[model samples]
Target: MRDGPAPGASAPTQTDMDLDLAPSPPRVEDLIAARRAKRQAILAKYSNGTSSTSTPVASQSSQAPLPALLIAEQSITRANSVAMSVDGTPAPEKYSQGERRASMSNSPPPLSAQDTAGDIGADLDKLDAADNLAFELAKGDEQDGMQAPDQETISKLEGGHDQISAADYDPSRDRREDEHKRLLGEVPHKPKVEDVMEIEEIEDVEEEDVDDMFAVAMGEPSKKTKKVKKTVSKPAPVLITTTALLDTAADAEGYYSVILGEQIDGGRYQVVSSLGKGMFANVVRGLVLQSPPEAEGILGAEVGKEVAIKIVRSQESMYRAGLKEAQILQKIRQADPDDKKHLVRLERTFEHRGHLCLVFESMSMNLRDVVKRFGKDVGLNISAVRTYAHQLFLALSLLKKLNIMHADIKPDNILVNERKNLLKLCDLGSASDASENDITPYLVSRFYRAPEIILGVPYDPALDIWSVGCTLYELYTGKILFPGRSNNQMLLLMMELKGRFNTKMIKKAKFQDAYFDEMGGFESVERDKVTGADVIRKIHLAKPTRDLRARLMPPTSVKMNDNEAKLLTSFIDLLDKCLALDPSRRITPREALSHPFIRG
Candidate 1:
């Protein structure tokens, strides 16, 4: 029944029609108020136990909007129920929505209608509580400028999933909160210096007590804490000296300062007195605290024994020379085990304060002291000379047998007993093997130097015999027979007594040009009286001015009897053979030992 009567009013526009058909949009405030009202109504229903149970599941699902808080509460309640089951039964497998709906349609209800209504009511109560908690939390988060906890966190909390327990406590979250609080000036700042001092103090306390604690725990007696004090040792004071004599002070030059009464060598030897000093070493008499095994039961060797300790200068050259001397002495000791050869015995060798020290048997005095005490520039008795000469020949024979050269031989180098009967050759510091070619030309003292040494001729054990000849003459006469102040004077004096060098000897001499001209005349170096400068001049001497035989005779102050004259003649003959100008014709130690002067 339509009378389609439209007129005048502008035909309804398309927009006006659409607007009339559309429903009015709800305001945000109205929606929020409605939600709150619904929540309160649900909460009141659950609290009064008067919620409508007549509502079917389908009507509830279709008509009522699903709220986030209600969904979360249902999920959490189901999870809690499954977790709290004590039957040890497996939980039902989860199903997709379609599968759940289909199953619900086909299967019988797992619960009674009343029980399902009660569960729904309980779930609504949980939802209300969760919604309140969320609202409060969100309000706090907004004030703090932080995001509120998400849906998952709310679910976990409603399920009572270990809230605030170690499993749920986040150390990182706490750290972040602490950092935020510190940035907001909620915590006081600590000073770096105070922190460092506190840490150091703790470490010191631990160090002082850790050992004691460990000891006590191990059932050991606890030790008292000891405060360690560091000590620094000051160097010995330096001594200054102006004379040529060496100082006892330690120096950078490697000289060990000898302190009197100081014990050295591990307290085995105590220095008693300084015996003597030389350019290369210092000789000190030491009291042996413990006698060496080798010295036991020997007549002159015993405990509390006195030994001459020769401490070599710390210089490298002197140390090496001292080492060589020790080796040679060891060889000598091995060669003559019976100690019959009249050579000084090396007791031992050791190092003390960086200096090589050699210990030897202490002798009463040297031959120089003998000459000074008994001979006194005149001469020793013929009987005494005969005894000493016999012993001297034995020592030379031993040296020749061993192929060793006593490069230094003088009265000062020979040692004797207090009675002057026992004699031993000592001071082999300059001695070398006979095969050594690098021998020093200025080895022997100038007064006792052999003629071949002055001529620079290659020498052998015979050179030692020449030195022995010169030494014997000095011992017998208590005077240096050929006392030359320099090498030039030494050669001149030798030529004056022995004779001019023969052509054959001069041709082989290494230093012949220095003492002789090309024409074979003596070129002597003499001091000028006016200038005190050396001047070389040629001298022609056909023969020796003084005979060695005459030189060996007793001094004019002494008179010889018949027996003395015969002994003197034999002694002169021995001297002549030893003092031969030509080393090749010189009498050897073995030959000299059998001479009438030594054997008879």
Candidate 2:
């Protein structure tokens, strides 16, 4: 120092001290030796279990002093006998990070020779006691199975006053246990209603379906729900009557009844009686168990009321046919604002046991029943015909506008409401979209079949007019106008009434050869020549020359006045236009509606 600082004077600045006592930079070997020494010192301290810091790594400066600690703990132990001599014990073992973590896990404490005899003896006694207790519990289980526990044994148990034998216990124990279980769960495990069903299966039921079902069963009022039941995981089961189970089989005639008092549509409807049967469906009279709000005041307010349920045959083809009929009926409702005025109302549609079921307003009877009720031979009065004809025309007009055809326009398919004196065109299963050039020849009942269909000619809705003429003739004369037993017979009957089909009409017929020759005349039949054996022969037949007026007008008890007779003539004239042999000359539905017979 140039001039040492005086005692008790200010300390030297950090920069001044660094410059005055600064040594030469250490060699690489010395630097490494210093670092190793520091690491060894830290390892010794930590391995000795004497470090304040719990972490394995500590300060470098603290470890730099003990370089021997880096050689090996065992070598250091041999070098530093003083450390062992002081304690007469080796330093605690050093552990790596992985070893340390492993040692912290739940492993049993290791046995040591240092364990006292008394501690070992105590552990043995504890094991023996556990073994004895387990054996006694097993004995008790066997004894319990063999015989009921005595009262003395029950009273001897802990809290004996509170315990009771099962024989002496109250029946209310089950109720208490169930309530306790229910309280512990999110929802009651047992069904709240004994009759609860899968929610998905009974979609028509309201959200409060359970409540309503219970209410009805208990003879209480129903509760309404505003919210719709869209999804449910474990909805309550619904109660249904078992009346229909036994009578669900078809009889010899393939007609079966949906038993009276049987519930359907989740108990919304109850079967009252069998209505009738069709080729592909069964009609039943049903009473609505509960009125739906949407259906109220529509179709004579049929909700919670009586209706006709047509359950189609379970076969896929029949079911699909029924669905088509339902679709057509729905289309009619959508197309016409005054649908209910002329067409039979389709109240609802649903599936029941794989069959398509259609619900419709219950009608008193059909036109066939009316014809049967009024002696067919004597025929119904002209007034009755006019009343029904007007409503039928309204229906036909609607169909014409939609370009749809009632392929099977028969008396059985026409329903009448006797109460209102109204007629509804029903059974649209045979109805189809009309096509001018694609008309199907297989159409209508034999008695009401148009001549064009019989001759296999492409026809339009004018075919329906021909059906109306036949229907009216039957209604007026109480006899089928063309009561032909077979197709050829029917054609012959038509020929007698309206003469033969023209050359062009015959040419267009696909099955022309079936009924006619190349000359556009009736094909000759095969007859027996010799040995009474049948032989093919081209036999000639006479052309038809029947009197329409004399055949249609027969003696009837229902007398007619001058005005009535005039109306009758107009009626016959309408039939003439409708029953024309040529489709082009046939009366249209629209034109028929304006005829004096229909309007009058």
Best by lDDT: 1
TM-score of 2: 0.54
Model 1 TM-score, 2 decimals: 0.57
TM-scores for all candidates? Answer: 0.57, 0.54
Q: Model 2 segments beyond 4 Å from truth?
A: 1-257, 292-304, 436-441, 524-544, 554-561
Q: Each candidate: what lDDT?
A: 0.60, 0.55
- Cα lDDT of model 1 by residue, 1-600, tens digit: 211213434444542232111112233335447645654454344323432433435545533322422343454345334431111243232334453333234222222335334555565456444433211101121122111123244334335211121111122332233323323433111123322211111112333335321222223224332211122212223332222224334455455667789998888889998877654577898998876566677655566878899998776667788999999999988876756668899988988877889999888887777766655644565656766777777777778777899877777788976445668999888788899844244656666778777777888888889888887776665556565645566787777777777889889877776666566666565555675654455455556655555445534455556666777788888888888889899898767766788656
Q: Distance (Å) between predicted and true CA of 82, model 2?
A: 99
**Range of the 10 consecutive residues with the lowest summed lDDT in candidate 2:** 134-143
Candidate 2 lDDT, tens digit per residue, 98-166? 543332222112211122122323333443333222111011221222121233442343133222211
Per-residue error for 576 in candidate 2, Å, reads: 0.8
Candidate that scores best on TM-score: 1
